[model samples]
Target: MRIAVAAPTGHVGRHLVPMLIRAGVKPLLLLRDPDRLAPDVRPEVDVAEVDLLDADAVVRAVSGVDALYWVDPPPAGHNPLAEYKLATASAARAVTEGGVGRVVFQSSVGAERRHGMGEIDGLAATEVALNATDANVVHLRCGYFFTNLEYQVDAIRAGALQVLLPVNQPMAWVSPRDIAEVAAGRLLSEEWRGRIVQAVHGPADLSWQQVVGIISEAVGKPLEVERIPEEEMRGTLAGFGMSAEQIDSLVGMSTGFLGGFTPEQERSVHSTTPTTLAEWAYTELKPMLQ
Candidate 1:
């Protein structure tokens, strides 16, 4: 199968590409900056330096590809929602015009609601467009990234974790590596058909308090969970140099996940992944704490 990966340098893409290679598939990488890809892996894959906003360019780049691994990359400009619409539209065009066979789209858990989730609304667009296509599409409705905890690294070390989410609500905090693993397994095989919603729920459902305990243990320090108010969180994001638009999106994301945010796809043996926070913290986060 002729496979293609967009944003091969991204958190999940980086992991996904190596898995594809190890599985003996040479993937065509569609990216804006070829140099962003690791120097060592560049030689093994086909590179197309095409901006995702350009439909013609993306269609051209992906033409004749059998499968595609597409995720709405982080907005390179200030208009994130606009970028998501255009990028997903371009990839969808590639599916139809370029005759791509399968699409493994990286979407978020709250995408089922499809709106009011700020940037996640953009991901929902990808799901909609792919679903319209004839190509086999699997929308990996992923959970809140474990990497998001990196934002609280300093706070965790200071013995207090100011969380934005409701402390009592259990959320699926997953590793990108695990998401990539599931995506690779799906892309490499052709067992299922139609639009499949697979939730990448890591190990177990965990509350913010439970998360803090696991993280605290890994960092070898006791930490407190301070659930900051939305406005305060706004100021914090602004302090970090996030623009107003980005802040609004994040704030909306918080509210969107509040109540009625349960994933449409119920957790089952297939939906749950194996990696736990303790395991990920020890390996990925513990080292970062140093």
Candidate 2:
């Protein structure tokens, strides 16, 4: 089977591509810069060097592919919603024009909510657009990525874990590996027809405090969990050179979480993956921190 993977070197795509190759399926990678792909994996899959924003180019990239794994890349500057809409629209057009048989979209947990969701609202919009298309579509509504902790490695090493939300509040988290695994399975099977929504949650819902404790044990050191106020989070993001829109979008996501906005329904047990906080801390987090 021939599959087209957008953002082939991205968080999930990096793992999904290798899994597809191992399954005896060929992947046509849509990469803006093919050089970003690992040298070793380049020989395994077909590469299409094309810009996703260009509708015509995207159509050509997915042409004749049996399935497309579409993941929206992080927004470049400010105005992530606009960026998402533009990219998703182009991709939708491509899926229709290219006659791709199936599509697996990477979305977020709070995407069902319309307001106060920040950037996740963009995923909701993307879902709407993709669902309107004639081809079979599967919306993979994923939870908070455990890999997001990689950004806190420096802070953890300094004995502090900074976050905008309350440490004691429970939140759902998922491993990128699990998301890739589910997407790969759907793409490889290509069986589900029409529209389907799958919630890819982690093994368990955990509080930030519990997660920090696991991190401390993994690194063999005590780490403090510091909660940054929403207003101050804006300043910190600004210091990091994020544009106003980018800062608002990110902070808005945290605000939504603090407000208790989350998935409306319970995720099925079948959708949950086996990776746990302790396991992720020992494997992915520890290696990055050390």
Candidate 3:
């Protein structure tokens, strides 16, 4: 079967494309710049460079695909919902025009809850838009990325670990590679279409303090977890060029953690991904710390 992947050069895509190929499914990778295509994808996969916002370009890239893997980047100017809206609309048009039958959207966990953040709202918009299509749409609401620790990797390397915010709060963190695996499964399996499959997290949950300890062991170094103050978080986020809305959204996310935003118990029933914090730390993060 033919699958069209948007942003095939992204973190998830880098892992996802190989899995799809191994399963005997052909992936049509769509990117804005072909030069960014990874070596593995460039030579073997069918690729198209087109402006994602351009309706004609989207249609051309998506045409003749049986399935789609949608990944929309954060919108410009901190309006998280705007870019997703644009991408979703463009994809919606392409799905109709190109005869694509199924779509696997990469969304965040708790999207259905509409919790305190612009991310929830933006994901909700995309979900609503995709629901309009006749094609089977599956919204894969992923959990908080364990890879978020990459930001703290430097601190771990330096033997001074700074747990950003929500230091004591436990989060259900899932690996991006595991998320990609689940997405690949749904994209290939016909029975999963038209379903809202939420890959909530792995076996257990961990607080930021535990995360630092795991990294310390994996990297073979002793480190201390120094929690960052809430007041400084806004400025730190601003340094990353986040919009006011985006900054507020992230700040609000920490509030949920503090206020007890636990994962629903039913997540294991529909979606089961088995990758723990230590496993992720040992595999993906250990080398980065070195």
Best by lDDT: 1
Task: Write model 1 residue lDDT over 1-290, tens digit each, in one string.
Answer: 99999888887898999999999998999998998888889889999999878999999999998888887777866668888889888979999999988889999899999899988988998899899999999999888888888777888778887767878889888888899999999889988888888899887888889988888888798977878898999998899888888887778877888875788878888778888889888998888889
Itemize residue pairs with steric clashes in candidate 1. Answer: none
Model 3: CA > 4 A from native: 76-78, 160-165, 226-229, 239-243
Question: Can you give the lDDT of residue 230 in candidate 1?
Answer: 88
User: Which is the winner by TM-score between candidate 1 and candidate 3?
Assistant: 1
Q: Per-candidate TM vs. native?
A: 0.95, 0.95, 0.87
TM-score of 2: 0.95
Residue 213, candidate 3: how far off, in angstroms? 1.6
lDDT of 3 by residue, 97-215 (tens): 88889899888766666656445666766777778888898888777788777877766777886544567777677788887888898789887556565655765667777877887
- The order by descending lDDT is 1, 2, 3
Candidate 1 regions off by >4 Å? Answer: none
Instruction: Report, for every candidate in turn, its global Cα lDDT versus the true structure.
Output: 0.87, 0.85, 0.75
Model 1's lDDT to the true fold? 0.87
As for candidate 3, its clashing pairs are none
Question: TM-score winner among the candidates?
Answer: 2
**What TM-score quantifies how close candidate 1 is to the native fold?**
0.95
